[model samples]
Target: MAITSIFNDAFVLTWDFILTIVDAVTPSHPAGHVVPAGHPGAGGEWPEYVSPGEGDSRCACPMLNAMANHGILPHDGKNISFKTMNETIRSTYNFSPSFCYFVPNYIARALDKDYFKDTFDLEQISVRNDKGIEHDASLTREDVRFQPDQGKPHIPFINELLATASGKDTSAEDPENALMLTSDDLARYSAKRRTDLENIGGKLDFIHKMFGSSNSATLLRIVGGHVSDLRPFLIDERIPDKWEPAIRSRVGLTMARFNLTVLPLEFSTRKHMKALAKAKKSG
Candidate 1:
């Protein structure tokens, strides 16, 4: 009974689940703010044997993926606990350009939500201070954050994109199956990317703009910009033909970030219908 709602629906959500999802979906990093609840400080890695540092037990840490993989209650109605699932998250993830933090939230939701018997109302989610500025100075420290040995200046970008980009920190022993998911599997996973973008488009758009500035452009140039894999629909062709060169200047973002746009109209409409039917029956 797999469940997926590209929108942020709040009906089936429990208090704990809703609180967690709220923090996960509305990333505070955009506001350059780090509240007591969560913060992405650095991209540190453990060699897997050195006394199994805090990373070993951090399934519920702020990064939505880690929290999803580590913190959420298992939906299988079994005794699956964070102690049991931490190893899986360490091994199930990988790093990539389009590998935004949103994927883990999707996987985590799947694990927590009762997909078969439950439905969510996507319109209920809300955001604050959505003026579209990336990395709100109010939330960030002007002081430098620690960076990995990887020689990149954008600590958060590197920590996020390069550090746990794969979402997993450990590698599978089975080389054949280690990160061996097919494009089909990736596409299925990739859908989460779109769902996440949709969930917090306002914040993400601002972050995308921040990265394009001269100071940060080089950082994004590597993984094709922060929001590199958007669909053609996301492309803003209206920039004056003259500024086109400036606005559409980067390499990775110059092309459509994604291969396609939203889920097919038919499927989306059908999902909505199914949701309505379920809602009516419940009412």
Candidate 2:
């Protein structure tokens, strides 16, 4: 069934977001027919012969099904389930839930690569095949952008920022004008990082610094894409008492969805350390 997207807002929608929404809203049949799982109708299970670029090859379709099953996407509208979607993701990616959950992220990345083709010449980018040697690959305009050098500055970084702000002749890298910080300043900064790592509130603040406010759209999209799987935390009673307030506060974000999406690895590391210590004591 052809699905029309209602996401026409100013928010930048990633390709995965579009696909997932489309899958969720689209009826199984044009005639609104619902087929059994193994039936040979439009609502039947996904076909077995799906090629890499067509039909079930796209990750978001299965994710949409998962969302529907978990009540994240309304089952009445699309009627797919998280279990069904999870099966498809596992079959396609051959990965565990932790890995398969990132399918939307992979899709977003691929779309980003294709989107960048318009800004940079993909023909200039060299890619290596299975042999580990670089080759031109004879890319077409329709090909995903393979420009590895795109991260390089077109001009000096400071100069570009200066041009945008004002035509200032000042350069930040100049040692003569550099302001030196004391040892106490460095120690205070290190102490603050340690303090942030010790609690959920500080960790959230750190996450905000990394990807929040104006730049939180991408992380939010990832969280939103997997809302069915992530939303359990909003209601789960097992979450640490100290972290409850912080998690609950951000549940209603329009574009800054899940806190876990931007959570630092150090948080997980701390948990691991605690577990290890507990095991050592018990053993």
Candidate 3:
């Protein structure tokens, strides 16, 4: 069934915050009614498909079932997309979920309400080929806010706070500013990150700096994205003991995900982590 996002005004956004929000889909849904999983098998996926624009070859009808399931399908209205989904999630949450959960929901939430189509059963849709039987590949103007006269096609980043690192020139997208960290900067960033995690008080930028970048916190901030930056802590499991294994597992998964090079490599996405790991997307 199409699900109404529970992340709406949810003060407590744990991994479930995103698990409940992202429609049960992944960048991996080959030859059915979603983005064709770039690789050929269940084990295959473009690791680089992590960022937006790097690869977003969706089925054009990305959320047909989701729309029908929610009874908010857009064909009667329009269609859902990154822009539309971002708007949908934003219309309710005001901020993206941040970290790995940040991007999917950001893209899922961007669409205007009009694109929220009615849902349908997967069994009913014909999927004999990669494109499916009759899904329209053409995106309507309503689906995307296309400029009549193009100067430059500016598709904004869904997770503006998301820092991309694809071995490409990031100078144009994200300019590097030398940060002089004083004791004061450390104190502030440290304190803020703690509060957000413990639900006392905090700032998202604190998490951003830990990731070696500085950006405002939004729903699209995927804490998992920054896992690579935490080297020593993971080497020693420095996470606070009071945190539940579930929570610890989440941090570990986030770390493991971005830190894919680590040893004892996990062989499955379905195991060895918290439910939250499912929410993390490199993008």
Candidate 4:
């Protein structure tokens, strides 16, 4: 009986050791999807783009939608864990680790999701609220009051902004006709959008205006303010083929760097608004 008891204890210990080894080898969250070969994060080719189908969720943010379209996020746009978002954004865009974490946490808090464990469906971020990320006068979205389906791209509005690009660069060797949007172009476009929305009795409060400014700054920083690069992402909700972030740094685009970019735009936006106001007052 003593020998039998000793053997049972030994077996139990062996089984526990095996289980620990298995746990160590397994991933906490299985991807459950095919990562393309040689992809950045999990190693694979860039996933093919697919439009969101009926009952598949989408958000007002074009960046997230583009990521989902390319299977960087879940293609179905459902139950996206914050950790998954952080990892993918950092790998895909080479954004700062801190910024990547900050965005997801900000969304979770704004949308009232469980910051620690709650997963967000893409559509949840589309909710229009004062605190929510989606707001009026978006670069790729129509005002909430004007458009019933704010999740989809607003092509005409986007084209209008694209037309504001300074002009094609004759100096570039490759992509012979590369168009660039300057800081001035973005500021003017942002100011014009605000005024146009106001004319139509659309609401774009200070918070929303700041959000729009931040997005403009992100666009410039990530894609180098190139109209060619912006087109596919803004209009088609697809990442440009072979896209690499223009901002290359070990720390990536940090919050301080991002803020520095945003401040000038904010100042420019204010300047444009004042000019418009003065013109109107004089007229």
- Please report the candidate that would top lDDT against the real structure: 4
Error of 1 at 226 (Å): 19
Q: Tens digit of lDDT per residue, candidate 3, span 1-283? A: 1344554324324553453334234332232212122311112221111111222222222222222223322323223343444333222222223333444332233321222343322222322233223211111111122332111112232111122222222333333321122222222332333333334232233223332211211101211222221111112212211111111121222322333322122212113222223334332
- For residue 147, what is the lDDT in candidate 1? 20
Give the runs in model 3 whose Cα sits over 4 Å from its true position. 1-12, 15-41, 45-102, 114-283
TM-score of 4: 0.81
Instruction: Give the local distance difference test score of model 4.
Output: 0.75
- Which tens-of-lDDT digit does each residue in 1-283 have in candidate 2? 1122123122234533544444445443222122223322223232332112212111112223332333323333232333443344333212233333343332323334332122211112222232111222110111113334321212232122122221122343554323322222222222233333343332333332332211222212322212222222122201111111111111122222223343433344345446554665799
For candidate 1, report its TM-score: 0.18
Instruction: Report the error of model 3 at residue 150, Å.
Output: 12
TM-score of each: 0.18, 0.19, 0.20, 0.81
| Model 4 weakest lDDT span, ten residues long | 28-37
User: Can you rank all candidates by TM-score, best first?
Assistant: 4, 3, 2, 1
Q: Residue by residue across 1-283, what tens digits does model 4's lDDT show?
A: 3475457446544654454455445543322222223554333245788988888788888888888998889889999998898878877765666677667866876777765799989888887766687777677788777786777889998999989999566766777348888888889988887777767777667777778888898788876777888998899888776666666554456665677788899889889978887888899
10 residues in a row with least lDDT, candidate 1: 237-246
**Candidate number that wins on lDDT, 1 or 2:** 2
Regions more than 4 Å wrong, model 4: 1-45, 167-171, 175-177
Whose TM-score is greatest here?
A: 4
